[model samples]
Target: MQNTVSSTEAKPKKKSLKARMQKFGSFLSGMVMPNIGAFIAWGLITAIFIPGGWAPNAGLATMVKPMVTFLLPLMIGYTGGEIIAGHRGGVVGAIATMGVIVGTSTPMFIGAMIMGPLGGWLIKKWDDAVQPHIRQGFEMLVNNFAAGILGMILAILGFFIMGPIVAAASAIMGAGVNYIISVHLLPLANIFIEPAKILFLNNAINQGILTPLGLEAASHAGKSILFLLEPDPGPGLGVLLAFSIFGKGTAKASAPSAAIIHFFGGIHEIYFPYVLMKPALFLAVIAGGVTGTTVFSVMNVGLKATPSPGSIFTLLAMSPKSVSNFIGLILGVTLAAAASFIVSAIILRRDKTPDTDAASLEDATAQMSAMKSGDSSEASSENIENARDVVANYDNVKKIIFACDAGMGSSAMGASLLRDKVKKAGIDMSVTNTAINNLKDEPGLLVVTQDELADRAAQKAPNAMRIAVDNFLSSPKYDSIVLNLKARDQMDSSAAEPKPAPAAKSTPSGALDNIDFAKISEIDFLRDDDKVGTATMATSLMKDRVKKNSKAATVKSLGINDIEDDENRLVIVTPEAAKNLKTRYTNIQVFSTKDLLNSPDYDKMVSELK
Candidate 1:
């Protein structure tokens, strides 16, 4: 009896439904307020810079434009990436940021059109190719570079391919808008659709229409819908009326929060939870959406691109000349709201209160806490041993990838950092960084990224192990990460079925001694240097060989002097000679062409050869 009393005492008292609803309402308010501030900032920036009349001073433009176009997108991308992949997913997040900036600024919507899909694809690809061999030092670096290159290439390709598709999609969307206005706004349909519009359509029209066009047409057109109503109702007023009349308990609680967000914050995301809670009322929301959109279309209401979720804050950002558009917006929102409230109340009047799953909620909360503490009971020793067995029996594990957004800046830096760390630990890992969108599934792949982008990696390679890193390129603590990865790899190897070894062939050296001489001849002698001396030296060395061979006359120097001191230094050669060289050389040193240009010995050798 004492034990039972102690257990009972440990449990906290449950809050009243009213208190819970109030808390949720407060949470909604907090969430929407910051978003409103961000939307206002975006609007002000767009108004001042984006081909509009409100130009700032030249100095301000220089500072503001970069902040808005570059930094803001990057920050958003990083945040979004984190949301998807985890905290370590910043690499992919950064890439997504680059994509957004490029896509938005590039001609004919190039960056805007292709960045998201491309970034997503590259993350997936990098995850598949590099996740497995991440433990190997040299292999990790190679894989990192490969992933980066592949991501960039894929982004460019996707941009080209997706351009026409986006154009077509835009055209279709426009046509659909026209159809909805013409067919769905009839008086009979307005009975249901108008109420549905109040629930969501008003905000959609504002966000989907006005913001994209940089116009303020919706507000003005909203007046017509009001003129037709018995009490001269505004657009979203109907939704309010419906809520007042029919909403109960939580629905009633959500109504005021929705009003605050819709009216002041211009955010529509808030209403979704309410709609989800009562799916039977979804048609009501749709009805309101159609009503609002149709009314706006009929009245020729439009707005400038203010991508913030629709609320009153968005309306305030519109041009002063757009009073009519604002009026139309109000009408649409009010009408839709009233309709939804009435429909929701009517539908739910006779129904019992929906069952709440307390156990599931408690379980979810517990799991979340466990994840935070890194204490999953399911990850037991026996399971780990089994996983290792599977991995040991498996074959063809070759690559490990680190993925980010642009695949240039952050991913490259991250890859380099990871390479150094892994090397120091004496791990023979293959790691690479790529854009998130270019991933393809492969065996023996492991993916490491900022925690935010893990979801994207998982989507690409379901079987691959994903390790989250807090920092992309800098190391405060990657040692633990490496150890965790090794353990995972061992488990996977142990779990997989073993495959037969290939037939062996007798050669001059052991398999470990195998070297491709042709690769050595064509190897870039200067890849790292930025000085002209490096290029000069490499060129003089090649020239000396050419001069000595003359026709040994088939060997000719082809602009070895012309190599630049840039990031990329590719050496092209005929297939026959390349193959021969690969057969001879086991390893190659990469040098920058700049080294040759600055070398005194190269200058002397070139003179002698000449």
Candidate 2:
């Protein structure tokens, strides 16, 4: 009892800390990420047109300093202020931001970020305190004057006070970084960075901290190694490759694809789960990070700016266009990957508990149906492993928002899948996505987020019903979401599966005559209960594609025996599954694919269904 009590108490405290950390990280990133386009524009200008740049056009180079020194910081300030208050705040934010730019000799990226939101927040506070008492018709004059006066005062204050303070802080940060390099201890920063990244602090570390420092350093040095530290995809690639080779069950199968996404697509969050599933893998990533950073430092390789997706292509684009720099960067990433792969493989192979692959990150923290009857998920924690058993009163949830750290990538894909599911189930709820920090505590809001971000989701929208999913692509929880939505609106007329568009209006291609397009309203993928995750994902992807193209066919994964023996449904299966399907049922139409998820024939196949 004592041990259980201690453990229970510890969880909330741990959750609170993580939530606070995420909140802090998200706050900083929120200021930077919205203004990334400005950063990229300046980066392109500097990269292609500066004296040391690829093109080295003196005419275009003239534009570089002005953009970086003035336009970029002002835009950042305006964006930060807009995030805090609104357009008025943005105006003041930029106003206040100008003071800092003039006050500091160095590029004042830090000062702009600080002043923007500070100006916005102060203006918002003034409005809140004074707006109710303002007379009706003269509102515009009074409001304008108030903003102007406050902004004027704030601008002066920023120039005399905040600008110098932030300049000092930026100097200290730059000195700290230089000191680390001087001691040849720069690589050790990964000891802290790697863990924070695994906790979904990648955005905070990258946008909030590294990018600002890196940009400032780049202004003087022409490039900065700080850009390479957080966005290095090498460690993640190494870990994923290890999992693909040495891991078991779903993890092994998923790692190869996850690796492609992480390395090329620059969605680094994909690898975090593999690390989370096996905590020992932290050593592998840390080792990789240290090796990569050491190689970069020794080679003196750096980029002009931070890469958005952090992909190899972006890294090269941002690289200084020198052969030696390219070699150094490639070698650093290669050796880093090699180091991580070796460490991760050894960890996987030597584990006495062979459960690393068997237990998914979701399985460790899933809390599905056990929280029914008004009990918090924590109350039913021990019993809530299976997502299918998850239940909730989604009747109160009129809108569904899939929340993630960055708000795009995984969350967008998840929203696409769930939106289709909700539409198919004839549910009327709106499904969308935004950054976790952007979530609001509005009534009828249901927030879905990855398990790692559950605490942050709660912190952002405490009143919202939060569901932690396995992943964005293929969580078993999605089916439960659909089913629960249906159950909640059982009495609604739209609760029935939607009727497919009529086939009579368009002639079928008769490519596969047996399919009988008029009779077929649905398509089925072969599903095995033990390997449900794969089938679910394939079905979702296929469904989304088919819905976009054909409009008349619904797609789902069903057991071989569960499929109806009728021409009204077309069954898609692997060649092996098709052979068994023929043995089991003669009436069902079958389309066999070497790859269900991706086939050259899929486009032609959808055309025939018309």
Candidate 3:
């Protein structure tokens, strides 16, 4: 009883920490995700339209300042505000942001992020407080005037108070970076950066902090090394290379492909999960980051602008068009990769799991997940074993989705990774990704998300099977999921025996009699005993087998009662279900499952669709 009580008490604390992290991640994502287009726009203008750029158009380049100084800050403010309190909040937030942008010589992006949301929150509070007291006749009057007054006061605060503070902060941050460079201690930046990157804070550090500093430096010197710190792929490259060589089982096989994607494809996020798979790998990434920073500092090299994708090609293209700069870029990347690879290889070799046993993998997975969950107590053997049961319900899911705060970068790559594995195994599973906000529960759907965002994903798709992993790029969970799906497929194929071979030609009775139709649709699978399980051996049983073949116009909006009472649409079910329904409902036409599955040209149609 004491143990159970203790365990119960621990769960809320774990949930609380997770909630805080999720909120922070959401806040940071809100600030960065919507503004990525602006970043890309500025990067392109700086890279190709500036005087030193490939196109070198001074006229077009004039748009850079307006875009950065006015447009970018305003957009950031608007987005932050909109996140807090909708459009009214966004308007005031942009207004308040101007105060910070006006006095600062540097880009005031970080300041905008703070001030915009603050302005929004202030207005939101005022509205919330005054909402009940306001008279009906004074609604518009109070709303408009209050908003304007709030906007003006906040603007003043931004200019007089927040503006100077931001300038000072920027100066201090810039000076610190410069001092490190001056002392030849630039490589130390990785000490802080590597750990932050591992925490999924790469976007915040790069876009929120470093970009402004790098832009300021670049404005004067035409280039800055600060741009590379957060976006650098070298450390990630090294880690993946090490894993490819020294990792066990599925990790070993996946690492090589991940390495190619991280290094050449310009997706640094691909390697983050690899490091997460083994937390000890953090030291390897840190060493590699330091090595790369040191090499770049030594060579006095910098890019003309930030490399958006952090791709090798983009990095090379943005390098100062000079031999020394080119050499610095190559040396930095190579050395970083080598340093990280060496350290990671040592760590992997030292921690080598010789057997790749399921129990061992579960413990390792639990440890990783527990660390990600911010729960220290979950490291026990019993807790680790229990974690394995979290996904037991997902064993036969047909569609898997990788979800993230932002749908594109890491989630997309993860889905692609699984899609390739599924396709190679000749499974017709659908694998994809979407933003967590867009996630929805569906029959037979499994949602995979980073453990940090698992709570949000669960809230969004409660009915879907959820697999939360510490990292998307690599997780033991993926291996388990794949193995389970393959096993289900094998079982399915074996179940087809003893039944008559599927009618090659369209008979009145068709493949539907054998296929588990409920597994493919929104309907629940019901057995004669009302138990739900795959009743057939052919694991490759098609989905929507009835609906896809016949023009059995589906009334998707109909409720169970509507389907029972109305005769407007055909209701397809197994013969047993049809018999059960016939005694109660006289109006609707009931089609046999086999008859629907054996629609005209059934074999050709099924083959073609497959």
Candidate 3's residue-wise lDDT over 463-559, tens digit each?
Answer: 6666676667765456445544654554455466666333211113443353332222222122222211232211113345534655232223221
Candidate 2's displacement at residue 265, Å, is 0.5
Q: For model 2, how does the per-residue alpha-carbon lDDT over 1-610 read when each residue is reduced to its tens digit?
A: 1101111132333456777888878878887887777787788888898776788899988987888889988988998888788899999899999999988887889899889999999999999999999988989998999889988888898889988998999999899988988788999999999989988899999998999999999888888889999889999999999989988777887789899988998888888888988999999999999999999999999998888877888888888868899999999999999999999999999977755332654332222222221223432221233322223345467899998887876788789999998887667889999988788878888788887787666656766677786567756567556655654464232335485222212112223544566677888877532335566687888877887885778887776535665767787766555544443344567776656677666676676665
Candidate ranking (TM-score, best to worst): 2, 3, 1
Per lDDT, the best of the predicted structures is: 2
Better of 1 and 3 by TM-score: 3
Which candidate, 1 or 3, would have the higher lDDT against the true structure?
3
lDDT of 1 by residue, 1-610 (tens): 1100111122333554533433333222222222334535644655565443267455544544455455544444444334334433434545544633454332222233234333544565566776776775676576557546654654455445544454455456545544554675433445553343323233223222223222111112311222122111223333444554565543454466455544565333334444555566666655565556556666665443343434455444543235566677667656655665566667666557753322343232322322321421122111232333322312233566776432333456567777776665445778787655455556667566544344445555556545554445333324334443444444344446385222111122112122222233232432211222343355456656646644121111222212221222223232222322222122221221222334333333223221
lDDT winner, 1 or 2: 2
TM per model?
0.38, 0.76, 0.65
- Model 2 sits at a Cα RMSD from the real structure of 10.8
- Model 3, runs deviating above 4 Å: 1-26, 132-142, 350-352, 357-407, 415-447, 455-465, 470-610
Off by more than 4 A, model 1: 1-40, 48-117, 120-124, 131-140, 175-287, 306-309, 318-320, 338-610
Candidate with top TM-score is 2
What is the number of backbone collisions in each predicted candidate, taken in the order shown?
Answer: 173, 3, 8
- Name the lDDT of candidate 3: 0.67
